[model samples]
Target: MRKLNKKLFSILSIVMLLLLAACGGGNTTTESNSNTGEDGVLSAKFGVISYLTGAGAAYGEAITNGLKLAQQDINALGEVNIELVIEDSAGKADQALNAAQKIMSDDSITAIIGPTLSTEFFAVAPEVDLNGIPILGTSTTVDGIPEIGDYVFRNAVPESLAIPAAIEKAVERTGATKVAMIYGNDDALTKGGFEVMERTAKEMGLEITTIETYQEGQSDYNAQLTKIKNTNPDLILASALYNEGAVIMDQARKMGIEIPFVGGNGFNSPQAIEIAGDAANGLIVATPYFGESSDPKIVEFNEKYEKEFGKKPDQFAAQAYDALFIYADALKRAGSSDREAFRESLAETKDLEGILGKFSFDEVGDVIMDVTVLEIKDGKFIEFE
Candidate 1:
């Protein structure tokens, strides 16, 4: 038993070390290519403005991996020479705006990939838009974010679509006639999902008996869940980020509430499973990509990703991968490096082949992705047929 404990300790230490290493140096590796074309023609620069450093760094790495793969393939064709200039949009609004300013100051970058989060995207949008540069959000799904700028487009499904399906899942499968809405009220992304969950649940005839909210970094969710328990709703619809989701799920399990738990897209994460332990076994959520997809394209991507990253890639990572390839497809279809033409070409995308469903951006710049209902069955994510 002592030897077993020691071995477990060693494994934990190694895992922690790996995580630290991954967190340390990220997205700092940029290609030092200094080649360029003639002055009159299109410059071969694509700006990747993303949260590639600090808190949202891992998210950026996933995106960077996808972008790098597409860039490599496109350049390998030898038909078009493209240089991806990656920039880190860290810190707050001011810092994000500064990054946009820097990207714009350099006239080389044809288009930008992301600011990652909706809040930061809003801050950077005006600057990038004023310069007539189009920004593609790889995974920022918050509703009403399209108002940030006309030049911004999203490759991920809007929160409105995914969150509603989750609500429907709860109402139909769990028989959740009365629900208590819980969410990270402080964040724009989380709040957007929460609002949709509320509206959709109401529309689907599920009574929202109570509403509970929490700010990020508040350790105890007991107070919020306490309110939820009082209402005695059939289930809780949590619009949560992965960080706080574990806490709520853990607390709910400890409270002895066997009524199933469901959450939004952000809850479809590995951390939620680790933190929720056995409680997460039955947890359900809505998402665009299923890590367990049996599709040939998904299998191919999964095999390649597992070989490179040494683990299964999450839906967030898939969004990043699909977004880059989608943009590349549009650029090739447009047949011109003209920035205006590229943006217009992106708008014309319809049912284009992609890793995450098809590329069909709606009028609001949100991708019309096929949202799937997923549940944690036996510690593994399985699609709800």
Candidate 2:
């Protein structure tokens, strides 16, 4: 009887030990999957939706390069490991929506960056906000973006701010009393830019000689340019993507229109200069970043980016680079990859020094940054003094 009792006790003890071990393993697994690894390093996954293979490819490429550089730097810090899952939106609103949906399906993605243009943001941001995932726009700069939801954030300065700043500087420089405007009426970015330009121009008491509109992919602007040229305006205000803006400037120049062009955010890319060639000279735009900045941070970023990408970084790249660091800071503050926690932490960001100067978010997740007016001179963007 004693031997039989001992055998029963032994089996019970073995079962209890096995159960405890299983529970311990389960706890470790959960911890590993949440925020920290067994090695005590923080980790998170980010999704990027960019217009990688379309008319906006230059913007997307710059954004990607900046993010890649930031990723490398963040990983090298030894505090966190960031894994980027990038999807090409191809500059389409529908594709952006699909990419956002696909990215949100991954429960591990803590946050998302991009959908490059504001039009795509309108499609993807609302859905992502409903899912409670933080979506940061590195390049979407239209009005009413942050109004989408609490989850939507952007480092890109809106046209409401940029256009006015550019116009103010250009007007001061040229003492312009009249302007001709051309804009892409289809895209949110360009349309928003035109509205701001018109409003600002009116408020400044500058007469608008003509207002012409075009679609996104339109190549020829002869009719509009002809009307603008006939007006004999002191300046031209263009709200278009880089490609369209370049073509318009080239055509306008060829047509003997010698007025300075005050352009929107789309003109911030170097591709504009490349496409327009001499026409790009005297082109003016407002940006949160200037590659010619003598600041140590800006200089270092320019050198490193030029070395890696074999070209200078533009405003898009600078903003995207700053965005990654912003995410990293939020992740560190949250101490976990919980989406809500990250969103809250990101909202608290203030005065973070970046290549774009001191970066912060307002009450509604809109960027609060200083703007610099720049002009294309001899195929380079120089600060408009």
Candidate 3:
């Protein structure tokens, strides 16, 4: 009977907690305490749901740097207070969803910028959408993801824009009547690239060549590369992650397999150079927009970054900067910190000039930006144009 009594009490406590949680508005006051600004204007808070400590940390850190710089500039404008919260996703969808939900429940945030991986972005986007809070993902390229949330959007260029351009550029240049396609079969980003490449290749009347598969974290790409070479393709289209992409490029080059390689955003970073060494020279990839920047504003941004980080800005930093500025732009246009108001404001943005490209979202929530062709030549990135 004593054991039964203990069980009954445990069940009763859980029931009470659930009841309290469901009591709508009961916990809201407590939650709102942290959101009230110094001027009592209830300043809007934004959460960055990201993979701050994972294989994605490099990208995550870039996003954080951009947001921080933008926040400082926003504060300096004497505008309403903006509180920023950053939570680590650890590169998991479930964790991303939970972290985002907790942030939304606080009533402080009017928007969010995160959940790095496309899978995680989609998972949390619906929850954020249901709450009517705008979610801007910095690096999601998976197709059909943005629709997960009505308030969901991304500042980064979508796969539809970048993936096809890479294909067209490679196809046009390589004259790859037959091109072997190797991709990460399970990764949403890589898979999207694969589908787009395959579709475009078929449409262009190029031979389907052969489709090969690889899993993430595979250090040895010799078997796959050898098979691709044996097919005697005119060019190699690789849909891969940064690490794996470098490995493939390096190994392929070592084996005397030389073809003008063109890839998606996976090759936009310096990581390709680091991994492929001198082999990376002359490799081409697609990015959102490559700026022929002469604007004084851009010069200032570059100088500031160089002074602080001791490195020139890469594509990752460019997108991150644009994401934060875009968020702030929405807030300015809305003239309020309210979540719904900002969402409406963001929707009205048309052809706004951004660092990476001119950003305008299409009907399907994809950012309308042209894919930029970038080449690695002489240890520096140059627009192939």
Candidate 4:
């Protein structure tokens, strides 16, 4: 009878211990269930959507490279451990929407970092905002982005600011009076850029001799280039992705259009020169980041990036790096990775010095930063000033 009682007691104790473990015992919780841990440290999860396998893959590669470096640096601080789940948008709107939907379904993701392009943001941001998830864009710079909702934000300076600066510099450098404009008609980014350039050209007292529109993936620009060449303008203003822009530059030079080309942020990559070769030698574009800055912060980042990636970082990499740090800083300031608290803290960001420059989000969620005029000389980007 004594042995039987002891065995029963032991079984009961085991059952109670199992129940307590199942119920978490008030101190242990799964990573997906809470942002706080037993040790009271922030372990937040984030999602990144970038075009890793399409025409915009160059930009996406740079963005993710920078993100990985930032993650390493931020995690090393020991106060915060950030884990990023990356999604490839493939430069497609539907792909971006699918990626964002997958991220929103996961309850653990505190914030999302991209959709890569302005057009992708237009497609995916509204739905993400409706789900109450915050998304910060690293390279999306077209107008009306942050206005999608309070949940959407971007670090890229808009075309409204960058385009005018580049155009003004082009006009000043070449004394260009008449200009020809070429743009991709099917995409929001290129279309918006074209509109900004048109208005800016008029404001700068430059005549638009001819305006030509091409489809996004059209390889043959002979018709458009021939028309633009007939105008014999002093310079050409282009709004296009690197692929199409490079083709345009190559075709323009092959057809004997030798005037200097002034472009927007889309042309801010070494791939342009890789494709256009000598045609891209004197290309002038305005961007928020100059990889060759004398600033110590910029120098350190560039050196590290080159050593790791075997190439110099571009504006996209710099912007994505800033975006991740901004998010992590907001997480620290809030002291909680809860969505509402994090969003509030992110909104209060002011005059934060980033790799690009000093940047802060305006009330509309657009980044306010200085645009630097850069001219591509000898296959490398150099400050125009």
Which one wins on lDDT?
Answer: 2
Listed per model in order, the count of residue pairs whose N, CA or C atoms clash below 3 Å is 0, 0, 0, 0
Better of 2 and 4 by lDDT: 2
After the best TM-score superposition of candidate 2, give how far the Cα of residue 181 lies from its true spot, in angstroms.
0.9
lDDT of 3 by residue, 1-385 (tens): 9999999999999999889879874455345434346665435678888788877787777667767776776667755566688988888999999889878876767899888888898789988898888898888877777777678888777666786777777666656688788899878888888887787778878886678889988898889888888888887777887788888888898998888676777656777888788777767778864533565666777777667777666666677778877777777777777888889888777787776657887775668876668777776668775
**Model 3: runs farther than 4 Å from truth?**
1-43, 79-81, 289-299, 309-312
Better of 3 and 4 by lDDT: 4
Off by over 4 Å in 1: 1-43, 77-81
Better of 1 and 2 by TM-score: 2
Candidate 4 runs further than 4 Å off: 1-32, 37-39
Could you give candidate 4's per-residue lDDT for residues 76-163 as a string of tens digits? 8878888899999999899999999877777888889998988888999999888888889988888889999998899987888898
Q: Global lDDT of each model?
A: 0.77, 0.90, 0.77, 0.87
- Candidate 2 has a TM-score of 0.86
Q: Where is model 4 poorest over a 10-residue stretch in terms of lDDT? A: 25-34
Consecutive 10-residue window with the lowest summed lDDT within model 2: 25-34
Q: Which residue pairs show backbone clashes in model 4?
A: none
Cα lDDT tens digits, model 1, 116-192, are 78888878877787788878887778876666667778877787888777667666776778888889988887888
As for candidate 3, its clashing pairs are none
C-alpha lDDT of residue 292 in model 3: 38
